[model samples]
Target: MLFSSSSTSLSSEVSQVLSENIPSRSTTLTGDSTQFQINEDLGTEDLTNGLPKKLIQLKKLKNGGTTIKKAKTDLEYCYDSLRLYENPYVATSRDKKSGYSIELCLDNKYKTLMFCDLQLNTDFPVYYDSSLENVAENIERENVTPLQIRGKIRIHIDRDDQALLITSQSISLKCFTKEYACFVDSGTGENTSSSKIIKELNNTEFFESSSYPKQQLKVTHHSSSDQKILLARGTYDYPFTFTLQANTFPATFSSFFGKTHFRIESSTSIMRIPSKPKGFLKFSKNENITDKIILTEEIKVKRVLPSTNMLKFEMFQLRSYNAASDVVVSVIGNSKLIEIGIPFQMILSIVKKDPSVELHDASLAVAQRMAIPSIDLKTMDILPEPYIKKSEYLLRTVESQSFDSDKTVYGFCFDDVIIPNYADGLPSWFKTFYFEASSFYPNYAALKVTHLLLFRINYSKNEVIEGLEVRKTYRVTVNFPVFVGDSDISTSSLLPKYEKFENISDLQDEPPLYSTVTVEGDN
Candidate 1:
């Protein structure tokens, strides 16, 4: 108050936003706490009280944990705001019931996309971009067609309650249905009505004098949680047919059911099935959070299983704030010891190497000397030899099939080198060695270098299958920098000894020419 303790506030913006009106202070209750208990307006039926209860009728055996029941009459499922979504799973030929699987993926807009049926054609390229229509249209045409007269009917619990709730407000009719003629009187030109068909085919005579009800369908939703409210309001149609017999039809009637005259059938039955809730609600026992929340917890962990006799090692390069650091590790199998080291090179001397020692045997001997559990000659080690010597590293044996050109060309392959752990401190006789391989197609100035080298041994059937059957081939490329000033003789006076291709500087903007070297082997 400009002058009293009871009230004194003045703000033009607040006054205008609040209707610029004054309240009667005389009517306020000074001590009453009712004003603080205002309920929030969530715009949906507040399930804060819990889901509407289901009336218990008859209970049957449970399938898994779900209970099944026969509706006293036809059922329907109606929602306030319904949204249909689907996700795809891998398609396999072994699925007998469904015959196929629809692969569903989410689009950028978070819409669920599914491919009903797809068949890979020979003309399909090895790689192609996938757009929504490209694959869907092609696959649907190639593998599936509309059931000229078929429809699907399903019952769903609108709310999260495991029990179905019978609510007149939410229950509605025929989400989907179809009607097909069973018989037609050609001379009379009258479509056999549902009542007529029932009379003619009542072999059991159960419906001899019964009249079906006009309200043939209804649907409802049960609240799954306080937040998962019932929503969606819409109608759907489906194709349906009554059972028939060949003898009941006249001799001239259409042979196929589709050819006969028929009217859309309308009857209501509860679409009762397993209760599944799709809403923004989760149980207390569920560990997952809303997708809108940022994930900070480690979601995945990989365990290292002990190798079954094969020698092993591991290596990694960790990134730091300032720079990248290298690490090496090795495992001594017999002793069950680990070693780590830093980058160090070893120059392997041919003099110390025994000429009689076979290459495969030599590698195994080296591994055994280091107390490695086991060594396979054909397996390639992923750890670089130099790092293992001083960096104290772990090693893992990798298969040749996993080798890539980048790994080989980027000095990723390494020889077996051993390092000791520092249980108490560094070793007393600490020394490191390094070895760098000579480049391929090398030569020396003022001299000719030996360029020929060849070696071959046993080949396995698996290798032939991978090489010849698939016709796998890879390209090897080399890039080197060149510097030149204007000169008429467009060539280096004495180019680097191994200039295998024409210099690109002369072509300016033209595409570079290439030469191929074909290797042949007699079958």
Candidate 2:
């Protein structure tokens, strides 16, 4: 009776269980019938508990995290989830200088999940990470946990001439996505292949949160009530956990962006103590006053790809034409989809190569291909709008080992080992956020994102086709119009419905309210 009879397959299971307990003509629903039959098809046990099998299956999934479950997820707003200031996060920055870092240690099936903004995509009722807690129906909890900011700091004391104390902490998250532009500059042009953030997408801050004073700083149950802490000479470790307002704020369309970034900006108010050292130490003449220091660390967030018009993955196969010999290339991966933050692995095979060619280096890159279809007014002809294309690479090596002549051995690149034929596991992380973050973005916009997997075989050929070929360098190019995003696993299928939808102009022209906030300044 909990779930009224719906078209779901559970109706059939309930029917079979019901027939065994009551007569065919009996309208009353009860187990007190004078007559009952137990057969092999209906099971040997008598009816004791009236719970259906569907509820039992859900009970098991609740204990373990299940992403993209069948049930409709209910959003439950939560705040100040944890106060973790004791555990030290894994220290990074191989350099000797003291610094800080953080990692998203998740308990879900996948280490990294996607996050969408509420304002960007207004179509569907998208759920937040908080829903994974206990908001979803039946299952009282999420398939995984969220947010553990683990970090450490070190300092050296030469007789404690001056003191440093931390009085407070805070964090912020930012989002910046754009479509097309020209003749513009905003500081990101150089690194992004001359691409600049459109004036419309410029955001001061998407989300800001600061630690509350009532909550314990170092420990939750300490007898003393002081929240401030003093940094003694040597090295000490610490961690902080924060809660994000995942829902209620503006969510995003399923599109993805490299510029969209989430990071922890700890706002700390520091005070210097005026003290004379025991020996030859020096101190500043200025009196001690509380100043501020801002520390930043990169964190990853992605929207949950529900079981709807889910993302797709496929085998990448192609052939490059050469009059001398045809170059056949096929790349395979363990999983169906290519997700970000995971090492990408592909089995690449090539055949019928020109004998004089020497394979030197190869790389896989995420190319966000863009073009606009339009009509020429003067010519009265159709032509694709010209959008200059470019690609970027950070040096990654492909380790090779002896194998059958037909196939090659490739492993991930670690140190500066020579890379001949083999490729390291997939370098599928964001490629500076260029991969297919969503279903090629914007289901309703002409400005859309298309992905291309460019596998270039860098080699040197002895024989030259042209008379003036001085360099003798050649490239066997293989291109795959590949797909790399989550696919649906639902019983039937559902379209991603947008609860709210905004066009380019409306979103850009909208006014944003401002409030007062404390910021740091240089002396």
Candidate 3:
């Protein structure tokens, strides 16, 4: 038998059934003995009228309560028949201009004949009216407004236990201009017609502004059936989508102060089992789900004190004493204590002793190195085995500025150097090794784990070869200690212990601040 009804009548019937069956308050079941009443109006109708009966079962329990059971002959059902098996059932984005897509799957037992009317609704409460009446009117109009749209499509589905891809619909937000005005009530005044405009925020002007996007879906199932018989199907599209809108704040204060919510609703037509025509039956169910679409990304900011003494390092005479040119390198910055996601600057200066030396093709690099330990098996002893250092470049420069011609000073400045958020690895630790200070001094053992900053410089020198000027290569390497602790370490904790001074000049009168230093021969 063919079953059909108007959209308004079907909506009313569904609403009635939902209101009657759904409990208003929570109830607990104790004993099994119980009995409940099922809606008799939902029973199957006579086939002569071309209408099938909707069978509903109510089983009695020992706890004196009743539970609703599925009808033995009910084949037609609403969206409750479908299930969601994918994550992000609702896609989200931060950019206001971005769009999103959704995927849905059908139950294995039912096959869809066709989808009637597919509607897409975008609601932005902050920018447009989101009242129930307005929403209903918008859906009925089926116009493409800045916040909502209703799509028309005709698609057939026969797959089971597979996804029904709906890739055509994409949701996005747009900017528009709105006018705001302030009015005063003219109750007992001279010109008491209604109200008078006192002031206006925008002076009736159009100002473009953007808002968040909240998308919803509505689909109509034409025909769906299982192995036994076909379920209820008709021409009019059913309301398959749930209420979805952008979040709002307290009306007492702010009107738009919350994240936008995107909703995805999947539903199936009400099903009726083929049974002896004795009573009427009606059933409608749907699933409503929502997710938040972030409008902006969050950033964390932190502040830290600056440390001077322990963070500075300088290396004098980086090359051999008898080299053609001498280079002195110095780095000034807070290295012992560093915070992730904070910007800081470091100063690097290089001074050449001889003014006559001309350097070309100069480059400098600073890298963080990791030292791994190893043991010697032949001697059955632990030896100072520093593995091949793995380096991560922190700063690099191919250009430098010269300060003076008399004593050439080249400086490279690293500005706004930021430690990445994911650099919180293992902390520095000390390793023990036996070393002799000199031939005359006695041997001693020392334990230390040092964070070394490798400074490298490469340049070319002008030389005469075979009665012609030639460019010869020259290189220099310098190592400086950089005490790197955890990213959360504070600068004040690494500073030397001394009394606070009232002013910069008074700091000289106070005891000098110093940190312990361990000196060992080069390995």
Candidate 4:
């Protein structure tokens, strides 16, 4: 009986296995037990041949699932991580001629990294005409050209990756002009008529060219680094030499309606991953791609005046006092303006009606008015330093008198008076304040240094009683405006004229002859 039961179970299991193995045209169960139908158009070859058909189907599934793994990894490069020590760097014509320096840095960690190739691409505007006004019209007519200057630097990484190998780099500047013709049409076709009246209109045209001729200036490398320098993983500094030329203008300018712009761009060809070979058995080329990491910053070229040319001088009167007798005080020097750490000269002249009146003493005082204290807690309640509380003189001087009997003029001259460098303290209600630029006050128009001249007169008692003596004492004050700038002053002379005669007739060999003739007529 046990054998009989076992036989029945075995028979049922065999029947189920056969049903699963056989390919069904209508429906089939997947490994997840999801049922789906097969397309009748695919044909029923597997349905007729059961076991072999199942083997074929499994082989096809295995082949479809197979994938070939990539052999070479993709190299990653990031331009956004690049940093420049100076951006929008300015290089004047003098600077460019003398050469300039720039610093750059890169932050990256990669094992398969190679060398970096740095390139500087410069573009300078070249106009056909010297006039800037016609630049728009010339541009619209496609008459403007661009002059290019290129420079390069290569950096190779060491095997240990500790430092980079650099080559000497240089910047070369060249200026040139281009000529082109522009045509403009002025006639309007709105007045076309059937009975055509052909009228010739006047046409006007002019030729234009650069004011200065073509010129070239070269600046050598001034970098301390050798031809092959080993730079570390940090910032790399490069210096270049520049030479100034006669025709050189400011680095960037707009003139005659046209503009000349100068720009420097840095680019690198490195940090790119090599591509794998075509076939499975093939290897990667390991060759560096031309792909480059271009920096976003573009350095600007400009021009700056030398320190010697920065100083300027001008003459302006301070004040005049009219009393019992006219007393005029004027300051004479290289300039009325004063700066810190610079010495200047000043002269005080006093004239009086009575030559007999002797000069006792004379002094010059510099002072400013104190600002009103605000209702703030810190300032209004507490008293501050002596310098803050009172409007004291920043500088004071007593001058000796020199009487000129011939001119009846008493004069005092002070030389090399230096302005002390003082900290510009904070503003409060009780302290005098000066702004970096200019400051305005409500009641008092503006804040400035006040110069006071105190003079004492020694006169006879009888002379004092006379109206000629304006007063026992005289005070003449003036507002002295000060500025901070260069001390050196620059002057220019007109170009000398040369004698030239295009024709002998224009030279006038001798003065024209004049003769007098009288005509008598009978009345």
Which regions of candidate 3 are displaced past 4 Å?
1-322, 326-330, 334-340, 352-366, 378-380, 386-388, 400-407, 423-450, 465-468, 491-523
Using TM-score, give the best candidate's number. 2
lDDT values, one for every candidate: 0.19, 0.30, 0.28, 0.28
Give, for candidate 4, the lowest lDDT window spanning 10 residues. Answer: 111-120
Model 4: lDDT of residue 515: 14
Residues 1-523, candidate 1, lDDT per residue (tens digit)?
0112111121111111112121211111111112222112112232222433332211111221112223222222121111111111111111112111111111221111111122222254101211112322222112222111122222222222222111111211111111121122223336643221201212212221111111112112222231221111111222222221111111111111111111112122121212233321232223232111000000110111112211112221321110111111122222111223322222211111112211110111111101001111223211111111111212222334432322211122334433443453434332111011111111100000011001111111111463574322221111111111111111112122232557766444643311111212211
Candidate 1 weakest lDDT stretch, 10 residues: 292-301
| lDDT of prediction 1 | 0.19
Candidate order by TM-score, highest to lowest? 2, 3, 4, 1
lDDT of 2: 0.30
lDDT of 4 by residue, 369-392 (tens): 321212122222211211111333
lDDT tens digits by residue: candidate 3, 286-365: 22111211111111111112332223232222222216646555666644333344545666666676544544434333
Candidate 1 deviant stretches above 4 angstroms? 1-44, 51-65, 68-410, 413-523
Q: Name model 4 segments beyond 4 Å from true.
A: 1-311, 368-407, 420-471, 484-523
How big is the positional error of residue 362 in model 2, measured in Å on the Cα after superposition?
19
What's the residue-level lDDT of 232 in candidate 1?
A: 18
| Local accuracy of candidate 2 as per-residue lDDT tens digits, 200-311 | 2222222112111111112111111234444433343333333332321112222222223233333334433334342213213323344433333334444333333333
